[model samples]
Structure formats: C-alpha cells, structure tokens
Target: MNAIHNTYWLLAAAAALILIGIGSSLLARRFGAPLLLVFLVVGMLAGIDGPGGIRFDDVAGAYRIGSFALAVILFDGGLRTRRESFRGVFAPTLLLATVGVVVTAALTGLAAQWLLGLGLVQALLLGSVVASTDAAAVFFLLRAGGLQLRSRVGATLEIESSANDPVAVLLTTLLAEFLAAPSGIEGSELLRELALQFGIGALGGALGGFAIAAALRTLPLSGGLAALFLGTAALFVFGATGSLHGSGFLAVYVAGVIVGNRNVPGFANLLSVFDAGTWLCQIVMFLVLGLLATPHTLGDALWPALGIAAFLMLVGRPLAVALCLVPFRYGKREIGFIAWVGLRGAVGIFLASIPMLMKLPNAELIFNVAFVVVLASLLVQGWTLGLAARLLDVALPHRDRAVRRVELDLPGSLEREMVGYAVAPGATILIGTALPGWARLVMVVRNGEIHMPDVAGSLSSGDYAYLLAPPGRVYRLDWLFAPPDEAIEAEREMFGEFSFDADVRLADVADFYALPIRAKDAPLTLAEHFARRYEHTIEVGDRVRLGPVSLIARELDDDGVRKVGLKLERLGNVLVRRPWLARLLPQRFVAR
Candidate 1:
C-alpha cells in the first residue's frame, strides 16, 4: 500500500509538471520565445533553487530518460521525412550532415579549449555535444513561422539538421569514452572506429527499416494496437542495434522513415501517437535536465557559456556551412540564412547529461555550460531566425494550404474532414451564430485548454476552434474566422504549374526562362510586366501563354496584378532549333 501510495504521488508530480510545462509553452508562444526555452526556464523555476524548491539530482535517471526521448524524437523526424521530400537536395544535404558537422565540431572544439580552458579531449567532447543543430528546434520554428523557403535551400537545411544528429551522437559517445579512458588515441584507430560506427549504423538502419515495414505489412491490427506495435518495434531496433555496438539512433530513425513510407496499417494513428509521445518526451527531458542543473553554479558558467555560443554562432556554424556547400551552388544569401538558423535545443542538453552521468572532471560545469549554449541558441538565434531569413532574401511567400483535411478509415470505410479556424483578434464569430449547414463546431482550444463551447460559451480572440465541415465550404469559413482586413487580403485561385514568386523582378528573370518580356530596360515587376501583354480577361486566375512559357496571375487586390507565377515548358523544341546545345540541355538550359 505504501509503494502504491508513493507511485500515485510520483504520478501526481508528473501531471503537475506537464501542466506547468504546457503553460510555459503558451507563455513563450505569446511572447515570441522558443517553446523549449520556456520549458527549460519553467523547469528551473520549479527546481531546488527556485520557488517550487523541488529537489532532483538524479543524473543517471535523467540520462536514461533523455536518451529514450531523443530516440522517439529522431524516429518521429524520420517517419515524417518522405523520400520525395529530398529529391534535388540530397547531395548538399548529405555534405552538410557529414562534412559540415565535422567542421563545426573541430572549430568549436578549438574555441572551447582556448576560451573555457578545458583539456583538448574534454573540449572536443563539448564541441561534439553541441555540434548538432537541434532537429526539433529547426523543424518546429521553420514550420511554425509559416515561411516558405526556396525548395532546395529549405529542404537541404531540414534534411541536414535531421540527418546530422546521428553523426553528432556518434562523435559524442566516442569522445566521451575516449575522455574516460587513459589509452592514447591513434589517428588510424580513430578513422577505423568512425568508419565502423557509420557503416554499421547505416546498414543496420536500412535493414531494420525494411524489417519493420515488412512486419507491419504482414500483421493487420487496430490503429491503437498498430501504433503500440510500431513503438515497440522501434524500441527493439534501438536496443538490438546497441547490443551489437551499432548506432542505435540511426537504426531507429531509418526504421521510422521506412515504416512511415510503406503502406502500414493505422498509419495516421502511428503518426498521432508518435507526435504526442515526442512532445511529452521533449517536455519531460528538458524539465528533468533543468532540474538537474544547480542554479548557483550557473552564475560562474554564464560568461564562458555565452562566449562559446558566440564563437559557434558567429564563426563556426557559418564557416562549416559555407565550406560544405561550396560545391552545391547555394547562393550566399541562402547559406547565410541556413547558418543563422542552427539552433541547439534538446540534443545538446541530452549530450551534456552524459558527461554528468559519467562523473567526468567538471561534469556539472560542462552540463551548465551546455545548457546555457542551448539557451543562447534558442533565445538569440531562434527568435531572430525568421527575420534573418527575410533579410537574407531567401524567404518564400507563404503558400496557402488547404484548411480542410480528410482522413479515411478502412474498417468502416468512412471519410471525414476537420476544418480548423483561428478567430483572429477583433474578428467576431458570435457564440450563438448559426454556422453553415455543412459545418459543426466540434471543440475550441483557448489558452491551451480544450472546451466544447456551444451557444453558452463565448468565442473570443485567439481561440483556436475545429469544425467538421464539407470540403466545398472550407473557403466560406474565412468570413466566419478571419478578421475583416484578412478577408479582403485573401487571393482568389490561380492557374499554372504554381511556379515563381511575386516579388521577383521581370528584368532579372526574363532571359532565364526566355520569358517574353520585350521591355527589358523598363523597371517592371513580374506581375506588372506580364499584365501588359496578357490579352486574357483580367480576373485573379487568368493564364497568359507566350510561346513555350505560361504566366498566371497568382494574386490580385484592389490595385492591380499583385503576383504572377511562371512555368517554362519542355525545352526540346529549343534544343532542336540549336542542335549543338543539345548535350548541355539538362545541365544548363533546363536548370530553371
């Protein structure tokens, strides 16, 4: 009875922690801060030094829990990474993941050793710990900011961040072990170890992924059960790979990707379960890490930590990105944005916990410094990331996504769509207003709490509500949810291959696509230039064809043509006209 009572108390504490963590996330979101940063702050505030005064000094437990959390997070990242997503950016992504990471670690190691006065091995280990750009942080901020990036640049950064974690993990583990041992590290032996670890990791992950996909295909289970089974298999892969001294992280991640891409039973449920689990794990992991940190020691570690962060952000990250992407032909602006967005979060902190668990020299200090680096990254870099993207001229205009989403269930063969709405500030959707006949308000999430508001409850600003609605009525929902000004700004549909941007100059773009921009000397916008020769009736979606090029009006307001999309047809005819240029078609002429 006493043991059961203790268990209940633990559960109570966990529930409270989660509740507080969520509140912190909301506050952070409101203040334009990174959610993970707030989570860390809240955890620290609730710890021994702060008001809550809850003592937690379990380094080993935190390490174990954090590792498990990372495994789940990495697996989820892999699961969502579709093969088609990396189509043209694979080479650059691979280089950034492998070569860029190594350069970052080396440069950071040098800085740490010089400034922080740690020994070479220890400094190198610290470098390795923080070298990884946090996949969760980058993925979350980019997606949340609603910034569309030029395809190759965005995809490369996302893929690099996700794929590079395994490398950092491997380096951290090996370096940690090296620091713990007295044996002199030989160059040849180091190379062999690196090769072996990477080889086993890649091979194991590929095979494990295939195995998981095959197993899921053979066994048909209910959604919940299928997700449980998939989670179980992931754990199994991680454990089994570890038993063979392989990269368990890589194995788990690859398995997730393969399983995700395959036609698995209960795929949506799997994604949903993993998403929830990953969030929970992230919270618990960060909180536990914060609890482990002694606030008193941070005062001394703060300056040194900031110095290291400055060097990494200002010097190491950019250097690495530029060097690795040199051969890939990425523009300087795109590279600059990518360099600035290397926000360190959970992964760095997790690696920091390792040194503490090992009880290495100044382990506590290392942990403190590592945590501060994450703080600096998330607070400084993460906050300014979107702005930097815009300033660097690499940002894409946000694409309007389908607000209506449909999910189909197999057993019942039922199809359903849940349309989400954000009641913009000052937008009035009356509590008792009659909704469209095809729609029904299901639930409202206000200040992070879910409430099934009906006629009795008020709909106020910032309330995110969901509705079950037919696909056709999704557009009409704008008037109900969007602010008056937003409703006016919404663009009508356009026709084309959905290419190019509104902001680009026609003079700069004319010769590239061989566009029919006759007035090359005139300073005209893409939409403005196209509108002059465009004979089609001026509606929002009028398409104008000129030779092999197609131009479509993407956006229009009260004024005139706002944005135009361009698509160049096949260049076979162009190549036929100039036979000698046929050999360079795909490599040169067809680049646009």
Candidate 2:
C-alpha cells in the first residue's frame, strides 16, 4: 500500500513538473529569457520551499537521471552533426576539448582552493566537473535562438560542448576515486582509461551510426513506428557503448548524425519528432537538477559560485579560445565571440550530480555553484551574444536587396538520372544573345520556374540549364555545372562558332523611361511647361520601370533627391528569406 501510494505520488509529481515546464517555456518568450533557466526556477519552486512540497534529496537518483538525460541529449546532438562542419573546426575543437579542458580544470581548481579555502581534491572535483562548457545546452540554445556566426565559431562551440563531456567526466571520476581510495589513480592508469574511453567511444559511435543507417534503410514499419526504432537504436548505441567502457554519448551522437544525414527510407517526419524529443530531454534535465537543489545550501555557496563563474567567463574560456583558435587563423572578433558564447547549462549540473551521487564532501556546494554558473551564463552571455557580435563588427551590414536561390529537394535516387549544367560563357545558346540548343536546354531554371525553354527564349549567361543526359555519367549535380576546364575538348567544340564579344543592346528607353516626372527630375523633363502641372517628382502618382522591375519615385526636392534614390518597389532581386536559417541548421550536420 505504501509502495502504491509512493508510485501515485511520483506520477503526480511528474505530471505537475511537465505542466510547470510547459508554462515556463511559454512564459520564457515573454521575459526574453532562456527556457532552461525558467525550467530550473520552476523546479526550484517544486522543491521543499515552493507549492508542491516534494522532497527529492536523492543524489544518486539525480545523478542517474542526469546521466541518462545527458546521454540522450548528446546522442541527439551527435546525430545532427554534419561531417563537413568538422573539417574546419575539428583541430581547434579537439584542442579545446583536451588541452583547454585540462588547463581550465587546473586553473579553476587552483582558484577554488585559494578563494573558497577548500581542499585540493574537493576543488579539483568542482573544477573538473565545471571545466568543460555544456555543449548540449550551448548548442541547443544557440541553434534554437537562430543565431548565425560568420564562420564555424558556432560549430566549434558545439563540437567542444559534445566532446568535452567525456573529458570532464573522466577527470571528475578519477579525482573522486582518488579521494575515495588512498592509492591514487596512477598517471598510466589515467592515460589508459582516457585512451580506451575515447578510442572505444569514437569507434563505437562510428560503427553504431553505420549500423543504424543500414537498419533504417532495410527496416520497414508504418504509422511512424520507425521513429521509435530509430530512437531506441540510438539510445541503445549510447547505453551499449557506455556499458562496454566506451563513450555511449559519442556512439549515440555519431550514430544520429549518420542516420540523420543518410537517405533513409522515411525519416523526414521522424526528424521533427526527434527534435521535440530533444527539447523534452533538455527541459526534464534542467528541471530535475533544479528540484534536487535545496535553497538553504545554495546561499552558502553563492559567493564561491559567483567567483568561479566570473573567473571561468573572464579568464578561462577566453584563454582557451585564444590558445585553440590562434593557430587556426581565427581573428580577434571570432575568438572574442567564441569566448562570450560559452554558455553552460545541463552538463555542469549533470557533472555536479555525479559528486553528489558519490556522496563526496561539499556536494551541495558544487550543485549550488553549478546552478549559479548556469544562471550567470544565460543572463550575461546568452543575452549579450548579438550585442557582442555587433560590437565586434563580426556581423555584415544588411544589403539593400537579396536574391533567393532555388532549393532543389531532388530525390537522391533521381540524382543518377539527371545532368545539371550551368549556362557557361561559351555555351552556344548563352553567348551573345544566341539561344541555347534545344538539346542543351532540356530544362531552364529561372526565378524558381523550371521549364523547357522556347527556341526563341535566349539562354542568358547566368542561367542554370539542365541537360537530359544520363546521370551516372557524372558524380554530382555540381559536376554538370563544372567550368570549361573540366569539360571535354569536344564540349568546347560547340562554342567556336559563337561570338565571344557582342555589343549588348538595351531598348531605346533604357535610361529614358516615360513616367510622371518627379519634381526634382521635373526640372530636367517638364521645366518648359507653362504652369507647374504637379508637385513634379515629389508628387504621389509617379512611377518608373527599369528592365523587368518597377521603381516608385517619392516626391522630393533637389536636396532630397540627392540623399534618397528612387524607392524600388520589389527590387530586381528576389527577396530570398534567410534559407530557412533554422531549418538549414539541421542540414549542416548532414553535410558533415
């Protein structure tokens, strides 16, 4: 009966917590705040102090839950990473993960011992746990916020976040064991464990990802049941690898990336489902960490926590980013931006829970400090990211107009069947007003329209013309668009007859368009009129056409005209929305 009651109470607690999470997420937008912090606050409310007096002081349970949540989060993150993104950022990211983490841990531990008057081992425990930035939290928040960096600064952060977990975890565990046993963890043993964990983790992730991809292709299930299989397989890879003394997080992440990128049988819808799942994981993870805290203990750790946060943000992260990024030719702004954006969240809290689980001394202090650090990061770093970007002049100025490119969701299967070609300088149809041969212009893509061009419709030099040639002949659609250098001499044979230089002619009214003259231009065109017919160029009913585009001339005097150009109504360029920026983010992983 007691067990039954406990189960009911636990279910009720979970239900209430979910509602709180939902409410917090909804309210977060209004506050211009991060939802993770909100989730933690909500969890705190449910603790011993707030409305629901559910006392959850179970450190071991918290650690277990936190660990599992982290695994899920990391796996999801890994699955989404594109292999291509790793090429540029990998070296620096690796350095940040290994060298940077070690340096940070050592420095932070020293600081903690000096400032907080803690023993070396306890300080090391705290330092080791908090040393690495929380990749899951940082990556998720950055991506969700739709923040765009000029280059792979964001990717480096993400890679560091995902990769640093194992290092921090390794450090914390080793230190904990050393404290527990008089016989310290030998250097050789430490080295061996590190080697094994990384080696196995990487290998496991690769193998597991390959396996999952294969299963996704071969397996068949309807009603979106396949997503469950994918999810289960991912979690299995994570758990199985970890159980085998491998980095399960690594395995799950690698597997997810592989499967996410592959042309699976049917995962378009599954991606959305998994995204939601990841969000759920984050919310639950943060909230659980918050619930495990006691407001009473936090007060004592507050000062130390603030100290650590300041040192890490001001000194450690910046130094690490500088050391790692300098060799990569990253500029001051890039390094500065990377340093500012190292927002910590779940991983630190999760690491804190580990010490608590082991019943290590000052566990509560660690938890409080970790929470404070997360809060500081979200408030200080998260909010100021855009401002920092601007101050650093890292952002490019907005253009007056932009063109939207056609995004082809071409089937991979059909890739082998199609041949893509760019309208080259020497192409018979594109050169000097000559139209493309019907054979070459099998399909012309212009302004989002794909159609067979009429013989009279000339192929402009910039057009992308598709040929109906067999696809297996080329490796990629891009290959079809290769420059003349890659083309056969026979391909160039068609260009010899075309004129290389032709004086392009515009219509007679190229510069002279018949429109209601503006007051400023009125002096130029209708000044001889006996009476002033209208406000001139400054009048409301003025319009002009430039090529296929139209322009609206606002009524303005000479000085005004000098300052402001004609207001273009629908500029010649198509207003391309930012490539579904967030949607493109998911695709980046596949590229890797």
Candidate 3:
C-alpha cells in the first residue's frame, strides 16, 4: 500500500509538471514567445527555488535523461532534414559546422577567461558548453516563426546546428577531462579516440536508418506500432554507440534521416510522432537542468554570466560566422541574421553539467553561468528572430501552405490524390488560370474561411489552392503553383500583406484606399500609428483588422509595434446580412 501511494504521487507529480509544460507551450505559441523559455521557467518554478520546493540534485540522473533527450531531438532533426537542403549549401554549412565551432570556442573561451578569471581549460570548457548552435531551439524557432526563410539561408542554419552538436560535445568532453587533470593521455590517442567516436556514431546511425526504413517498407504495421519500432531502434542505436564510446548524437540523427527520407507507409504520421516525442524530450531535459541549479548560486555569478553572454552574442558569434564563411559567399545580412540566431538551448546546459559531474573546480558556478547564457539567448535572440529576418529582407513570404488539406477517403482507390499549395505573392498563375489536364483546382481557403471553387476563379497571394491530381502525374501541378518569373524579385513592404514601396506614407495609404485617418494619426510613423490604438503590448505578427483595412505589427519589441504592415480590402467586398451590420462593428479589432 505504501509503495502504491508513492507510485501514485510520482505519477501525479509527473502529470502536473507535464500539464504545466504543455500549457506553457500553448501560451508561448499564442504570444509568439519561445516555447523553450516557458519550459525552462516552469522548471525553475517547480524546483527548490520556487513554492513547490521540489528538491532534485541528481547530476547522474539528469545527465542520463539529457542524453536520451538529446538523442531524440537529434534524430528528429535528421529525419526532417531534406537531402536537397544539405546539397544546396553544403560547402558553407559544413565549414560553418567545423571551422565555425573552433573559432566560436576559441573566441568565447578567451572572453570567459578574461571575464570570469578562469584557468585555460576551465574557460575552454565553458566555451565548449556554448560552442554549438542548438538544433532544438533553431528548429522550433523556424517552425514557430510562421515565416519561411529564403531557402539557402534557412537550410544553412538548420544544417549547421545539427552538424555542429557532436563537435561541441567532443570539445566539452576533452576540455572537461583536461580540466580534471588526467594529463597522461597522449595527443595521438586522443585524436584516435575522437575519430572512432565520430566514425562509429555515423556508421551506427546509417545502419539503424537502413534497418528501420527496410522494416517500415516490409511490415504492415499501424502508425503507432511504427512509431514504437522507430523509437526502439533509435534508442538502441544511441545506447549501442554510447557503450562503444561513440557519438550517440551522430548515430541516432543519421538513423533518423535515413528512415525519414524514404517513402514508407504512415511516414507522415511517424513524423508527427517524432515531433511530439522531441517536444516532450526537450521539455523534460530543460526542466531537469533547471531543477539542478540553485537560484542563490546563480545570483552570485550573475554579472560574470551576463558579461560572458554579451561577449558571446556581440563579438564571438559574428566574428566566428565571418571568419568561417570567408571561403564561401554569403551576404552580410544573411551572416548577421545567422550570427544573431545562434541560440543556446538544451545542449549547452547539459554540457555545463559535465564539469559538475567530473567534480571540476567552479563546476557549479559554470553550470549557473551556462543557465544564464541560455536564458539570455532565448529571451533576446529568439524574441527578435522574425523582426531581424524581415529587417534584413532575408525572409520570403511563407505562402507554401495556403490551403487546408483535404482527403478523398475513396474506397479502394489509389490513383487520385489531393494536394494543397499556398499561392505565393507575385505568382504568375491567376486563380482562373488553367491547370494541367491531369489535375483540377478544387478549393480556395483564405483567412480561415473555405470556399469551394466549383467554377473558374482568380487566385491571389496567401490563397490556399487545393487541387486533385492523379498520383503518378501530380508533378505537373508544380508549374502552375510556382511564383511568377520576374527580372528581379522586389521586396514589397508589407503593411498586413499589402505590398508597397518605402516611399508610401500613412496619408498616401489612407488617401489611395479612401479610408479615413484622423488628423492626429496622420504624422505618426507606420509603427507609431499602430501604437496609439493598442491598450496593451502588441507582439510581432499580431493583427488588428479595421473592417476592410488590416494593420499587422510587423516588428515588435517590449515597446509594442516597432513596425506595422497594412492591408486594405475593397469596401465592396465586405459581406454582411445587412450592410449596416459591418458599419456598426468596431472599426479595429485585434487578433491574437
């Protein structure tokens, strides 16, 4: 009965923590905040430092949990990554992963030594902790940003984060060993061991990938079973490689990619499973790390942590990005965005625990500092991501999924397939344009409303164009959905999806559309004009629709909208049971 009670409490505690995590994640999503931020904060709140007073100080247990979480995240990253994406920016991204890690480590190490007054190895260990761009954070940011990057830049950053994790791990392990003073290990042996870890990790991952893919293709398993098999195989590879002193990160990731890329029954469903599992893993890992830190110790190292974080952000990252990309060609803005976006997440904090586990001097202090750095990175870099991307003109309007997915559910039929594509701005094909003989345009979904295109119609930017095509010949649909061919793609200034040039002013916007703007609002800048209307903070991407005109907060900080984009609708297009009903509603209502 006592055992049963203890088990019941354990289950309840786990359930409560997980519920908070999920709720926090939903809140983050709604507010355009980083999900990891909520996870970390909720964790801190659940720890000894907060009211619940849960005391968790098991370093070994934390490390073990972290190891599995990292493996799962890596595997998911690898699975989702496209080979073509890698092929597109291989040279620069590869260089960035390897050379960039070295430069970032060295620069950050120097700063740590100077700022924290630590010894060489200890400083380097701190450096290694933060050396890699976190795959988990970067992946989430890209997905949650609700914007698609220009293909090259997005792919490069994604690949760089995944590719560099092992490098950072190796560096941290080596530095921790040296810091703990096992000086008798020869340089040659160290190199050989490092080589073995990479070699075996990659090989194990590839083998696991093939095995999973083969099983998926041959077996008539349900989606749940497939997910179960995939998870089991992934964990097996991670464990196998780790036992052999190999890079478990590399093995699981490689395995995931191999399985993910291949066409298998329930592959899409498998991906969804991976995504959920990865989220759970990230939440658990970060929460445990947060629980490990004592709030008072973190307070003592506060200033040094801030200084080191600043150095890493302002100096170390950009310098490393510039130096590493010297061999390849990337514009300054792309490099700048990349530099700013190198967020530290689960990996950095996990690496910080290594020194503590090894009983190195100042290990707890370093852990505290690492926690601080992760906090700063997520809070600053993560928050400003969408704004920075737009300001740099590196983001392409993400219209790729304009339509809600529709399935035929036809009995015993495999010939016909349904597909959805978002009509990008500047697309050449109009709505009424004829599709290929093999396919038929079925529906258009816009602004959360679906309209069946039973007759020919014109398509516009942000319109979800749904079509049906014979599965084998669906390739022809690409031509119609492709963006317009133009001499140079103009970066249209967006005020809510309406495109205008920089010279366009508030008065011009009102006058051109015959919309009323008060004399008080006339002189306000785009960002300032919107600021006058909101009673509360307006986050980036928040929208306020004024009957026919929409105002979107394009660039936002703590100070509300830093930039605004406007969209105007033809007054005639407004639909109402009684036209006066539209006129009676509030002119502006904000959407979360």
Candidate 4:
C-alpha cells in the first residue's frame, strides 16, 4: 500500500512540474527569458535542494529520457528545414558542424584545464560536452524572437545546430571511453570509430528517410495516424543506427531532412503534431536534467563553471567561428552573430550525464559544473541574442507579418494541399495582384457563409479564401496575403522607389541615370547580370551593385527574374525625391 501511494505521489509530482513549466512559458516569452531555462528552474525548485524537497537522484533514468527527448527534437528540426535553404550554404555549414565543433572543443578544453584543474582528457571531455549548439534552444528562440535572418546566415545556423550534435556526441563518448580505459584506446581506433559513426549514420539516415517518405505518400493513413507513424519510424531509425554503433543523432536528423523535403501526404498534420511534440520533449528533457542537478553541489563549482561559460561564449566560440568562416568569405558581422548565437542547453547537460553514467574521476564535478554553465549561458547569451543580431546587422528587414493560414490535405493527392488564408485589408490580392497560374481558387468564406469562387466574385477584407496549390510552391502565395503596412514598408525602405521589368537593358538604364557602364557589359539585361553574378539560383532580395545604383530582384518565376527595383547607392533619399532633376544630372554630381 505504501509503494502504491508512493507511485501515485511521483506521478502527481511529475504532472505538476510539467504543467508549471508549460504555464511559466507565458511569462518567459513576455519577459524575453529563455523558455528552456524556465523549465529547468521549475524542476530544480521541485528537487530535494529546493523547497519542494523531492529526493530524486537517478542518472540512468535521466539519461534515457534525455536521449529520447533529444531524438524527437532533432527530428522535428530536420522536418522543418526546407531543402531550398541549403543552396550555397552546404559547404560552410558542413565545416561549421564538423571542424567547427572540434575547434571550439579544443579552445574550451584549454580553459577548462586551467580553471577546473582537470586532467587533459577530462578537460577536453568537458569541452566536447558543451561544444555543439543546442537545436531546441536555437529553433525556439529564433521563432520566439520573430527574427528573419538573412538567408545565408539563418540557413547555416539552423543546419549546423542540427548537424553538429552527432560530432559532439562522438567526441564526448570517445573522450569518456579514454578516461574509463586510457591504456586500451589508440589513435587508429579513434579514427576508425569516427569514420564509422559518420559514414554509417549518413547511409542509414538517407535510406530510412526515403522509405518513410515513400510510405507517407503511398499509405492511406489519416493525419493523426500518419504523424504517429512518422514519429515511431524516426525513433526506429535512431535505435537501429545506434545498435550498429553509428551516430543515432545524425541518422535521425538526416532522416528528418529527407522526409521533410519530399512530397508526402498529411505534411501539415505532421508539422502541427511535431510542433507540439517537440515542445513537450524540450520541457521534459530540461525538467529531468534540472531534477538530476543538486543546486547545493553546484555552489562548489559555480565560479569555475561561470568562467568556463564566459570563455566559451566570448573567446572560444568567436575565434573558432572566425577561423572556420574565413575561407568561406563570411562577413565579419555574419560570423560574429553566429558565434554569439552558439547557445548551450540540454545537449550539454545531457552529454555531461555520460561522465556520471561512466563513473569517471571527477564525474560529479563535471555534471555540477556543466549544470552551472548551462544556467549561465541561458541567462547571459540567450538574453542578448536578439540585440546581437540587430547590432551586428545580420537580421533582415521585416517584410511580412504572420497571417491566419490553414492547410488541409486533399484526399487521394500527394501533390496538392488546400490552403486557406484570411484576406487582410490592403492585401496585394485585394488590390491588383494575381494568383500564380498554378494556384486555383476553390472556395471563399464571407460572414461565415461558404461560396464557390465564381459566386464569391473577389476576395474582400475578412473573407477567407481557399486555393489548391502544390505543397512546395505554397509559400510563394504568402506575399499576396501580407498586411499592407509591412508590404509598403518593405517596398519603400528596402526595395527602393522605382520598379521596372528585369528584361530592360543595363545600357538603357545607365543612359537614363547617367550610370557608368563598361562597353562589354552595356548590352546585358538586369536578369542576365543577376545570373552572371550569383552562382546559385537568384532569390528575391538579391542585390547587384552597378556603379552608383543597385538592382534588386523584386520578383522571380520559373524562367528568371521578372522585376527589379533600382536604388541609388549613395544619394538614394536625396536623389529619389528629386527624380526629374536627378535624371537630368550625372549620378556623380548627384552624389556630391
């Protein structure tokens, strides 16, 4: 009877902690606190060291929970990552994920050895534990802060955060093994292990991802069932990869990317389910880690942990990022922003658990110090992320506001989704913008009454319009429904005053504005110039400078650039206002 009562009490406590964590998120967002930190604090408060006085010290249990939670979180991150985001970023991102982790670990290990007085191997283990950026923390904060980073910077960070975990995990495990049996390990064995971890993980992930995608497309599964199937299959892949001594984290994340990029039925449903699932996983993982930590024990290692955290954030991360990104030609601002966003969260704490599980020397010290480091990181770096992005000029100008969008799966179809949007006042569609040729309007809801597109005539403010569009191409429709103010602000501020057809000859524009043009390049059109300048596919917002003027790609299509916006590089405000006078004078004189 006492055992049954104790079990009931444990269940209630767990439920209460989770609920409190969820509720505290509102305050975290309102105050710009890191949500994971809030969850961690809640669990700590309920632990034995805190007022709640719940005595729980279960390292093995916490490790199991953390591993599962991390797998789900990584899978969710992969599913949301669009394949187009990888264009022109794969090489740099890969370097950051692999070589960058090693550089960061090496730099941080030196600091740990000096501060914590640990042996070389143990110091490197400590460094590797906290090396990789946490995917959960990065993904959550980027969305919560409402940041629209430049394509290159954002994609690199997202992919690196997801991809680097496997490298860090491998490093930590190898170091822990070395500490456990120093005489038995060798350099050649370590190299072989690293190769197998990556090679096998990659091959397995790719195969599993394709299989999952194919099943989702062909199976007649409902939305809920499809989500469950995907979650289970992802875990299966993770387990299978680990059983083969490969990096399970890498396999699961890669599988997620493949499945997400493929055309599968019930994608919207999968996203919605995983969105909630990832949140739950993060909360649980943080809570368990928090419960595992004893705040009183952390006091002994607090200062050293704080020192290590400070060094990692300032010197270690930035130096590694600069070294890794120099060959890639990343701007100073981009590199700085990426280094600043290298937040350590559950991954660090989870990795620290391995030392405890292995019973290595100073294992308890490592866990306690890691706990402090995570806390300090959340308090300092997480708090300043938004400001850093803005100060460094890495965040892109806000061009779109969120709108009410609903996606519905079409039965018997894997290619199309029925997307619905609430037409806002001053929406481009409400004005004169036309839907793409591939999009077909099906229905509209006005005043809670549903009507066919023909009967509805034209969409009005507050009217809900539904259209069938290819899943991959639906994002292109968002601009048509964007709020008027953001659209106007974007056009006026970032895109410039005048728009023209992209097919216009550069020679004609140069003659009109008195721009200096080389004889060889005089005959090139704006589209041709963009194609020549950018090696990858040209996207909207891409800019090419021609002497004093900048040509911005304002619109795109299957063929190439459709429209371009001209901005005076130096005298944009002054010359734009005096358009007639500016046209008459040479651009050099206008600049003076």
TM-scores, all candidates, are 0.72, 0.69, 0.73, 0.80
Point out where model 4 deviates above 4 Å: 400-419, 422-592
For each candidate in the order shown, give its overall lDDT on alpha carbons.
0.73, 0.65, 0.76, 0.84
The numbered model that scores best in lDDT is 4
RMSD score of candidate 4 (Å):
5.7
lDDT of 1 by residue, 1-592 (tens): 9999999998998789889889767777777777777778888888898887988998888888887887777778788776666786788888888888888999998998988888988998889889988887877777766766655667777778878887898788778777788586666777787777677877787888888878877987777777777777788888788677777877787787777677666766667876777788778888887787775887766788899999999999999999987787677776788899888988898888787878888777778888888889988998887788767756643435323233332211122356677777655365344676777787888888888967427777777877776432355566566555444344322233334555466665555445564565347765666545432123444455656766666555445566665544557544346656435433322221
Q: Which of candidates 1 and 2 is the stronger one according to TM-score?
A: 1
The residue pairs found clashing in candidate 4 are: none
Could you tell which candidate, 2 or 4, scores higher by lDDT? 4
**TM-score for candidate 4, residues paired by index:** 0.80
Regions of model 3 farther than 4 Å from truth: 398-433, 436-592
**Candidate 1 accuracy as lDDT:** 0.73
Clashing pairs in 3: 402-464, 403-464, 431-458, 431-459, 495-565, 495-566, 496-565, 496-566
lDDT winner, 1 or 4: 4
- Cα RMSD to native, each candidate? 12.9, 15.6, 11.6, 5.7
